[model samples]
Target: MRNVILYVNLTLDGHLAGPAGELDWMLFDPEMNIALSGEMRSRVDTILTGRAFHHGIEENFRAQASDPASPAELVDFATWMISTPQVVFSRSLAEVAAPHRLAGEDLAAEVAALKALPGKDMVLFGGVSIVQQFVRAGLVDEYWIKLYPTAIGAGQPLFTEQRTRLELVDSKAWASGILTLRYRPAR
Candidate 1:
């Protein structure tokens, strides 16, 4: 079975995004970008996302991959992003283009099926609702949170009201003040 990893960036106060789903405060560290690409290359082969975030992610990466001015590491990472398979979970989207597919409406069932398939682990990039569904269903096997230094007073909280118990398995603190924390759901 494959692992379903929730890889997200959050503020010090735990907000994954602002009230309007703004991620303007996220740290854009080059070193972190390279590390993320490396990790993704080794650990995951699929990108699981919700409809709200799919287009933006695709557009950004596509541009980065084609831009000659982008750094080598970023260009490589962007290339990886566009080449990897993506599964978009949505009830409204009739279809998605190449390298992207529309997932079934039953999120848990779809995930279970995917997990049972022969492949590398899958990473979930959140758009709030989809992340909350996975969290509420207790479907996520691991959490990779890149905690930013800033604290946003008001925004969409990552944990919401759930009292989830997680065991810290690994962590790394960067000089840039960003902390990468890895956790597993306490069994």
Candidate 2:
């Protein structure tokens, strides 16, 4: 079965986003771009995300890929981002557009079915609630968290209400003060 990886960015205080869901704090430098294009993008064949995040990402990447003045690395990343199959978990959304599927109420089943498929791997680009559900269900195989230097006093945290023991597999620190920590749930 393909591994289900969670790739997310968080602040020093463990918040995924600000109180208002703002992501202006993240430093998307060349190192990040390289990792996105060379590591994460190359390994994943599918992307799982929440509905709102899906819409934003789809729109943003589609636009970036089409722009002539965009950086080559970003353009490449955008191409993969728009082309890869995306599963958006949402109960309120009845129908969705192409290259994207709406995963109804049964999130765990849907994730299981995806894992059973013969593919490279899958990455979960979350919007809090979905990540919490997957984490609670123990569906995530690995976590690639980009920890920024600054802290958000109050916001949406990465882990909530659940106690999980993770073993650090690898780590790397970039010049931009972003620390990439890779972990797996302790067996």
What lDDT would each prediction earn against the true structure?
0.89, 0.87
- Each candidate: RMSD to true structure? 1.1, 1.2
In candidate 2, what are the lDDT values of residues 90-111, reduced to their tens digit?
8788887877888867877888
What range of 10 consecutive residues in model 2 has the weakest lDDT sum?
A: 28-37
What is the TM-score of each predicted model, taking all chains together?
0.96, 0.95
Off-target runs (Cα >4 Å) in candidate 1 are none
- Give candidate 2's total backbone clashes: 0
Across 1-187, the per-residue lDDT of candidate 1 in tens digits comes to 8999999889999888998888899877778767866976799999999987887788998999999998888888888887888999988999999888999888889999999999999999878888988988898999999999999899888886689999999998887899999999998
